[model samples]
Target: MSLHADALTTLRDWEAPDDEQEALRRRYLTHLERHPDGMLRAGRPDHVTASTLVLDAAGTSVLLTLHAKSGRWFQVGGHTEPEDATLAGAALREALEETGIARADLALDPVPLLLDAHHVPFCGPGENVHHLDVMFVAHAAASAAPSISEESLDLAWWPVDGLPDAELAPFVARALARRRHAGQAGSASGAAGSSSDGGGSSRAAADQPSR
Candidate 1:
């Protein structure tokens, strides 16, 4: 199967010239060169999905998960199912389900798009194509509680500026940047009435032993 021109056009409209875009194309091409129909398998015109890098009360932090298989910290996202009017909904659904956050509370109407292309381990049965995923920024409420699910092994919020630089997904990092730019900025939990997991909350609870 050939790459969809419409999807390619969308990619062009997604973002301005950057090294990341070029790298994404190369990654997609490399994967397609091996197993075709990878994108088609996902029922996507092209292999893309909207994604979210949700932040918490602390303006300095953002949520990230260690993907079960890859063990890489990344934003929440998945494929664009037919029922989804736009890829963003698909991302929202995936983020909520996979992260066990009841609601993603996506903040933006027209989120900035990031052309993320990368290779992961096998998706499911008969899946082997690399993807040119068009990731977008989505945000969640600071009070949202993120539960670790099977899709993820570890989940946590890290300071945006202090985010680990080693082996971090570029898309996850860029999404954080866009989310903050969109006025979805998070503040470190410190004020009154903060959620349980926020930097605020009760200091007494913070002294509890590991469960």
Candidate 2:
């Protein structure tokens, strides 16, 4: 199936992280149902954007880009391309391009760790846009270094424990929390079944914590 169709299918079946997220998911689904080109950049008011938070091998540090436009430190991600097979593919492609990481050295989780719906005012010429961002988690070897892309003002690694107060994107905290929970769950499950248990942990962590 096409990536757009695949996205629609994924959202249709996805167990959203909370009532708020579920409501947003339903809105995204409804938008897709009404607009066939909803996932594209030209989709106008709304579109799908994929982002990946790249962790070091130890999962303690995350690579962040100082987005040239927004001047904010955020994960690597962008709009979906026509050739992208899935949302995860789009996210990984963005990550590799933004971070200069070889696909061979990156380990990406296919299932998204977070879904964020937010607005971007400058995406178009005097047009307000809404992004239904699908967020994924990935890991690169500690030895791997990231190169700065023209899209970013700079690139650097930040410890999850000591992220700076103001530079982080809003989704960063939520994604990191989910990643930590998954890690802890896997550790508690022990090495023999850790892999399988880790999979379950992702689903459980996908649920947003009660506010």
Candidate 3:
């Protein structure tokens, strides 16, 4: 099946964790239906992108990259490549390439954690592009050191509750809140050993001129 079709299926099968997630999922599916090339970067009108929230082993902190273009800390992700077969695979690939996180060491929950529709600049002259982003959560050792990539100015781990001041995207706050909620619930369910599987911080920066 084509990647676009694959994306449709992925979104179709996923049971949204909340009303907001359900709305985003519906928007993504609608976009896909309207644009057959929606999954490709060259899709013109807009495209589907994948991102991941990299959490530490204890899930207390997250790894973020200071995007060279936006100059703000954002999750590691980018346009989907041809090798990507599924949305989750695309997310993992972007995370691995951008963060230098070993695939073997990262444990990704393939389900969608968050969905965001945001504007991205620099597509072409007088042309606006939007990214329907599918976000995921991955866990790695808290001690794992991320090797900075050319796409980022720096890489750092920020406390879930104590994030530094910067041009953070609005979606970042929402994603963080979901992560914290999941962590609290996970902690409460730890005694039972239940396997709990669990964006937007870059919208305005992507729209505005780089500082």
Which stretches of candidate 2 lie above 4 Å from their native place? 165-170, 184-211
Tens-digit lDDT track for model 1 on 1-211? Answer: 1234334434444545488577775555544444344345463333544566666644457788877777677776666555554444556677777677766343433334566555544655544444566565545667677788777888888877666555444555665455454332223323443655454543222112111
Q: Which portions of model 1 show Cα errors greater than 4 Å? A: 1-12, 17-46, 124-128, 164-173, 176-211
- Tens-digit per-residue lDDT, 21-130, candidate 2: 78888888888899888889888888888999888877677898888988778888999999998887899999999999887888777777677788888788546798
TM-score of each: 0.61, 0.82, 0.77
Backbone clashes, each candidate: 9, 0, 1
**TM-score for predicted model 2 compared with the true structure:** 0.82
Sorting all predicted structures by TM-score, with the top scorer first, yields 2, 3, 1
- Which of candidates 1 and 2 reaches a greater lDDT? 2
Which residue pairs collide in model 2, if any?
Answer: none
Worst 10 residues of 3 by lDDT: 202-211
Regions of candidate 3 where Cα sits further than 4 Å from its true position? 165-211
Alpha-carbon deviation at 38 in model 1, angstroms = 6.9
* Candidate that scores best on lDDT: 2
